[model samples]
Target: MKEPSPRRLPTGVAAAAGVLLIIPVLALLIVPLYAKKGPQLWGFPFFYWYQFLWVFLASGFTYSAYVLIERARRGERR
Candidate 1:
């Protein structure tokens, strides 16, 4: 397989860059939402469990994005 070519122009580079730029922002969006105090969830309190659940939820999203990106890259190779 051939190495993917780099974008020649700033516009193309910027467009490619733009997609990745939103990822950090998306990852951070859940942080504040979990920072509230509230009642317990199951045995743990909302503050504790909410952050704990975010770990699994964020893992799911990260895995999904990786799989999708892999699929698209493989498709391009064929």
Candidate 2:
């Protein structure tokens, strides 16, 4: 009987995953620290908008990273 090859993570994929995990955590942790008085950028207070903006930024980065990782895995299989 032919044995199936063992699964393993490529270094690049592992590094990408590590970056994806860290960014959001850092964003969350750092946002609150700047939750104080500040000038508005476009009529919105910096304190409020800063945190709000990062929510989208973080989501975008996470989603993009996930897609790239999926693509990489698919390519690896071929």
In terms of lDDT, model 2 sits at 0.79
lDDT per residue for candidate 2 within 1-78, as digits (tens), equals 867755566888878877987887786788666677677777778787878888898888888888877887788778
Candidate 1 C-alpha lDDT tens digits along 1-78: 978775243454444545555554575576776566677777787778866776776666566655656555565556
Alpha-carbon TM-score of each model against the true structure:
0.58, 0.71
Name the 10 consecutive residues with the lowest summed lDDT in model 2. Answer: 1-10
lDDT of residue 33 for candidate 2: 67
| Per-residue error (Å), model 2, residue 58 | 1.2
Q: For every candidate structure, what is the RMSD over all alpha carbons to the true structure, in angstroms?
A: 5.2, 2.9
lDDT of each: 0.61, 0.79
TM value for model 1 = 0.58
